[model samples]
Target: MLQKTYDSQICSLARALELVGERWSLLIVRDALFAGVTRFNDFQHNLGIATNVLASRLEAFVDAGIMERREVHGSPRQHTYALTAKGRDLAPTLVALTSWGDRWATDGEPPILFHHADCGAAVGVETTCARCGAVGHDGVQVAPGPGMPAEYLADRRPARPPQP
Candidate 1:
């Protein structure tokens, strides 16, 4: 678990909230990626998210490196949204969350079932380390990588000044 400093708590949640915690953000990611709806009008028509809110969410998503804006030719000077590599990395997170929701939230069975398109069998999801064959929760631990915050630098001093 993350440390309980006020700033850490707020920042941690805010970072994730920018993607999934908002009213329509995850749905936006879902539609853009899975449903193949790209245009502003298509999202509006499909999700019914208010115009202003959708605009704000799109801008936020772009700023967070989750989506990129690209020019749309032969149109009235509008742009389209595309996923970034970092954004595409969220695929596993989305899939795990969706699977958990399918298991626990639905009343009877999962309303939707995911099958292997090639083999045509019901599938269960699991996470395994490619480096090691261990297949348990203890086998998985998160460590900061190149994208981590500057304070994560090993040479940095501990008990640093509080952030605002």
Candidate 2:
């Protein structure tokens, strides 16, 4: 379990990890986003996760503004979990991670495919430069951004260029 905090770290990725860093949290979000799972029981069944753990993750997600828990009109104490815009925004991350897993982690061909909903074309993700339109991470560089504390970055730099 991740019991400690990355409070000393001044990075957005660290913050993101704090929110959805757990394997099951990401899996739950993936099912909610891709498989349209909305109910607690559905998530429990699909993921085969313990009720307590699922409940905690769902609560955390709701608190983080990632998902909204809505009461079902006709049922008592029944609700549906819906991904907010912020939660749906994780789709690309899941897709890219899935692609990477298929390529490097799996032994066989991809078992699933992601396609463009509008044109039905196969979809893929990549990092691109806005100015030169350069594709991939090779052209990427890390420097002080507006959010980074100047002193922190003044004497520190990335050990290697980012591959993502």
Candidate 3:
């Protein structure tokens, strides 16, 4: 079982989980961002989500700025969900989680295979940057932004006492 931490004290990781921890929330984003689920009907049909639940989740996503609703050709009142930049940035997180799941959760063989369209070679779930060619988990890192607190940094790495 996971140990519980208060949100105020364990602010950073808690903040991340607060955004993504809800059930079916990240999956909804995954479907929209990677699977190309555009319309309300598409999300419901592709995911087999109940109509009311799907609508509520979509609204929550929109409110969180992960996705935006845009008017498609079909109906002026109807809108299609599209991933915003914030949502697109989550690809790496999803990729890492997918890699972990593939490694630990799989039987001897992968039931589902992903192929590289260009090379036609089967690709295991891994994040590779075309520009840098950096591979493996250590290659990925995130720096705290301006919003991060100096106190938090100090707590993490306090200055040592002066030597005699």
Q: Which segments of candidate 3 are over 4 A away from where they belong?
A: 1-6, 112-164
lDDT of 3 by residue, 1-164 (tens): 43334456535667666666666777788787677888999888888888998888888778878889899787799999999998898876776576676789987765445556699896555567889775776676555568778877767764455576
lDDT of 2 by residue, 91-141 (tens): 999999999999999989998899999999999888877776647665666
TM-score: model 3 vs. ground truth: 0.66
Candidates, ranked, lDDT:
2, 1, 3
Please list the C-alpha lDDT of all candidates, in the order they appear. 0.75, 0.90, 0.75
Q: Considering TM-score, where higher is better, how would the candidates rank from best to worst?
A: 2, 1, 3
Q: What lDDT is reached at residue 50 by model 1? A: 95
Q: Please, what is the TM-score per model?
A: 0.67, 0.90, 0.66
Over 4 Å off in model 2, which ranges?
154-164
Best by TM-score: 2
lDDT of candidate 1 over 105-138, digit per residue (tens): 8788776666667999965668777886548875
Backbone atom clashes (below 3 Å) for every candidate: 0, 0, 0
- How accurate locally is residue 80 in candidate 1, as Cα lDDT from 0 to 100? 91
